[model samples]
Target: MDIKNKVIVITGGGRGLGRAMALELAAKGAQLALADMNREDLDTTIGLCMEQGVIARGYVANVAVEADVEQLFQDVVSDFGALHGLINNAGITRDGLFIKAKDGKVVGKMSLEQWNQVVDVNQTGTFLCTREAACQMIELGNEGCIINISSVSRSGNMGQTNYTATKAAVEAMAVTWAKELARYGIRAASIAPGYIGTEMVMSMKPEALEKIASGIPAKRLGKPEEIARTVSFILENDYVNGRCIEVDGALRI
Candidate 1:
């Protein structure tokens, strides 16, 4: 689709990759409805996008909450009069082994708290947002697309049982949605990113971050803008659907 003037709703658009995509899309003439838990971050993003001469509004929300997700789409429709795209970018990590063992004894394990928290935000949250987006788009007879943010960890990271499951689910779901929602004139796709040089990842100890970078064929981390560019490509290309594109710098992991 021609990106200009399209109304796109991006969850977790306050910072990191979501913010980057919002800024990039805004620059290309898209009106944005950005949702995040942090009002300050949302305000920051809104300010940046507005400076680009685009219509940008910030909605404070938690994607995991069904009520919040419902309100978000309703507000987007009321504000923009149409919904064109949705980026399911809001996610969290609760990394831990499914079962931790010391010596010959199992002294620790992943808590249900950790499991539920990550699943709720990453899995359930994506489901909720996409469902609302589908309903809104179909009811309005709007042709739109959905992007789910997956992770390289979807392949199974050593210490990310909860996160891995959700990421894998994210990648698999786009195919299902694409097949199921094709009749509704909606396309679904996923982007699985490797370690990107984001604020949160860069905050990690240099040694650890470098160790990860060394594993990638690119010999460096990916940039948020790179992922943003992929989003743009997916939007502009009409035939790219029901697929999971890995933006992982050729990293096997």
Candidate 2:
């Protein structure tokens, strides 16, 4: 589908990969409904999109909240009249081993709080947003695309049981949605990024960063725009569906 003049909604569009995708889509003449909980960051993103000369609006939303997700879609439809695409990019991480470790030794079990928080935001949030977007697309009776932001860690990560599970579930939902929504002309796909050098990664210890980078075949981390480019590819390619494109520098985590 041509991105020009298309109405696209991106969850967690205030910063990181979400912000990058928003700018890229806006540059292509897409009308953007950028949603995030951080009002300041959302405003910054809006400014950047406006600099690209696109019509973009920012909405403060917590994707995990069903009411927020529902209202957000309604607001987008009200503003843009129709929704063409959705990028389920909002996610959070609470890293902890299922068996807690201290100094590489087993200490205790992971907290229920940690597990539930990650699952609530990453998995449930994606589901709610996708459901609302699908409803809107079906209502309009037009073909649309939905891209879920997954992670290479979905296969499993040492200290990311909750995070990995949530991402894995996202890919599963993507496949299921693709098959179910196909009749309605709505395609669903996912992008699993490897070690990307976003602010989240930058916050890691220097040695830890080096260790992770060494594992990647590319010998470096990925850029947010690389993921954004993949999103654009999925949006423009009508035949691609029910697949998770791994943008991981050939690294299997």
Candidate 3:
């Protein structure tokens, strides 16, 4: 499970937590295949990883598409010659109440489009990427680790029906994959991150950010590197399988 020289694929590696993870793993001497829809962002991350003296490549793929996910793994293994780890970090959020009513009459509700978009990217994307990555690892006789990026909101956050459902499903999928893939020496796990100081989160109104920090017992937002470090820990510890590591600063939503 040593990360040094291991080849790892990180979906959504163009920015945010995915970028943080790519840097962390690169620092540990891991080869990286970073996938993202933004070619510019992907190139930026690739350059950063390369600066750390590790082999890094960028692939533009939509994790939600079956063909894209399949081709991503194939390309990674072809370039790196082996697949050692996969981090399913590609996800989207379209937060809305499942049902919204006013004065005893329905006003609005989460649209089918919102539900389907999040499900396709967060839940189905994880499934597709993991399946293809596992196939590559098994066929190549490599022991690998798969880490799904879940969320603290998986417990059912207000205004996040679609996101919450997909987050929960990915966590459950990790557990199932751990049990199912053990025979092939591939371990699966998940990390549930709280409100972190990513660019998107930090762009919220100052008051909103303060309110969120006040809710967490830690009295502050999490750093992206904190979750990145947790990823490294799971990949290094062979015994840590089928579990969701919460990096939520003791917050419960």
Candidate 4:
């Protein structure tokens, strides 16, 4: 599981935790095939990785689409000649209460659209990407690793019924994949991160951020690099499989 010169594919590599992971792996000499929906962001991440003196390429892709995901893996192998790792980091959040009520009367409920949007990108996207990646690995006789980016909210969050459901599914999927794909020399695992200092999270009001940090035992937000490092650890450790690592700063919810 040596990372040097290994070809790794990272979905959602345009920004945030995915970008952090790309840089970390590049620093360790892993070749990168970065996929994202944003061309500009993808190019920026690629250039950053290239500056680390590793081979980095960018592809515009939507992971929820079967055709897009299949083509992504094919394109990566065509370019790198092998697939060694995949990070299912592409996800979106559509937060809403399952049932919003006022004065004992139902005011609103989670829309099918909200549920489908999150499920399609987070849960189904992970499934599609992992299936295609596993096929590539087995056919090429390459030992590989797949890491899904789950969330602390998988346990259930008040305003995130859709997001929570999908997060839980991705974690469960990694466990199932670990059991199913062992004979093929591929390992599957997941990482659930707490509130991290990503651009989106950091942009929240300072008072809101402080309240979040106060709730965690660590009394601070997790760094994107912390999760990125965990990804590298899992990929490099052959024995670490079928488990979800919580980088949540001791947060329960």
Tens-digit per-residue lDDT, 199-252, candidate 3: 999999999999999999999999999999999999999999999999999997
Q: Across residues 177-240, which tens digit of lDDT does each residue of candidate 1 receive?
A: 9999999889999999998999999999999998999989999999999999999999888788
TM-score winner, 2 or 3: 3
- Ordered by lDDT, highest first, the candidates read 3, 4, 1, 2
Scored by lDDT, the top model is 3
RMSD of 2: 1.9
Deviation from native of the Cα of residue 109 in model 3, angstroms: 0.9
Query: Where in model 3 is the C-alpha error above 4 Å?
Result: none
Per-candidate local distance difference test: 0.94, 0.93, 0.96, 0.96
Residues 1-253, candidate 4: write the lDDT tens digits. 9999999999999999999999999999999999999999999999999999999999999999999999999999999999999999999988878998999999999999999999999999999999999999999999999999999999988999999999999999999999999999999999999999999899999999999999999999999999999999999999999999999999973
- Alpha-carbon TM-score of each model against the true structure: 0.98, 0.96, 0.99, 0.99
- The alpha-carbon lDDT assigned to residue 123 of candidate 3 equals 98
Tens digit of per-residue lDDT, candidate 2, span 9-55: 99999999989999899889999999999999999999999999999
Model 3 scores worst on lDDT over the 10 consecutive residues at 244-253
Cα error, residue 148 of model 4, in Å, equals 0.8
Candidate 3 backbone collisions, by pair:
none
After superposition on all C-alphas, the RMSD of every candidate to the true structure, in Å, is 0.9, 1.9, 0.8, 0.9
TM-score of 2: 0.96
